[model samples]
Target: MAKSNQTKSKEETGASRGRKGDRADEIVTAAFEEFTVKGYAGTRLEDVAARAKVSKGLPYLYFKTKEELFKAVVRSVLTPAFDEMRDLMLASDLPSEDFLKGPFLAFLQDLVKSRRMLIARLLISEGHKHPELTRFYYDHVVSKGIAALRAFIDRGVERGELKPTGLHDFPQLLVAPALMAVIWRSLFEAHAHLDTDEFLKTHINLVADAITTGNRGHETS
Candidate 1:
């Protein structure tokens, strides 16, 4: 009887933790929607709780404040996907041109399609006003992304696949078009429908052409 009770207690605790995790995920998803639509300054915990279909006070139980919740939203949504991409960039033996044209390009396209882009736009427009958000985003997303891309570029140069030019020192240049796409889609899509797929593909090819030694003939002296 004692052994059976102990097993039952362990199962109950596990189930309780699972339910808490599920609730947290629901809250985070709802928070993402709210933040995307409302912006950080405009979003409220009560609104997020309502969107999550939970009591107003419940969000505070999980997150002490809106800033903390916003951080949680990024951590849950964007960080894991980016970390996977970074890890792939670090580990893959694929040539830099192929990697950029293939997996890296695909990742950027998918990012434009996801809520991550919405939040990214939000960060750009509002992050300056909120130092915490700016710092968190930089520390968690921007710095790591730049480092990973730099490493990837360095590897490409070492492999003789990419020219040892100033471009290798500035990986952000490669991704600038993606950020422009995100902003344009949000601000001008109705006026001018951006062909995101075609645009990103073209951007990837341009980067590949600019960096890859095989295309050096295309460059001017």
Candidate 2:
């Protein structure tokens, strides 16, 4: 009977995990839609539940509050991008101007495709009201991204492929254009009539040109 009880407990554990997974998926999906359309401040748990077709109370089983749900959505979107950038940085045998360009280009493409611009705008708009949520985003997403970029730029400088800019400025050089691109596409493009891909390609070229050393006989303007 003890052995049978152990087997039953294991089955129950498996069942609980499956239920938790399902619930988490539901909440995330719901949060994505609601947050995408309404912004974080405008979204409600009931709206998420309605969108997910789950009981309103069910979201609490996965996330304690709407802020937590929003953070989860942001994490779900940005974590993979960070990991990809980290991997690209790691796999480079030598740091060169073009070496950094590939991962940044790929990341920019993915960022544009993901409509994360809308999510970012929402975060910026609502972040002031929910300082904790904004702080969490900084701690988890932006700070880590800046650190990663700084490391890559430092590597390039050490390899003599890039100029010896201060590390503090290195992240700004690498990240500012990408941030500007997102803002332009999401916020100003309607008025500015900008083509995002074209803008991204041009921006990438400009950044690559700026970072590469002339001694390497690489083209720089």
Summarize candidate 2's per-residue lDDT along 1-221 as a digit string, tens digits: 99999999999999999988988887897798889898887899989998988998988877899888888887886676677777777666644666655756767766765666667777767778888887988888788877777777777776677777664475766556666777777778788776666677777778778767754543343
lDDT of each: 0.89, 0.75
Candidate 1 lDDT tens digits, 77-190: 899999999999999877778889999999989888777888899989998899999899899999999999898888778777898888767889878888998989989999
Candidate 1, residue 68: Cα displacement in angstroms equals: 0.6
Stretches of candidate 2 above 4 Å error?
Answer: 1-5, 166-170, 214-221
The ten-residue window of minimal lDDT in model 1 covers 212-221
* Per-prediction TM-score to the true structure, in the order listed: 0.93, 0.86
Cα lDDT for residue 182, candidate 1: 92
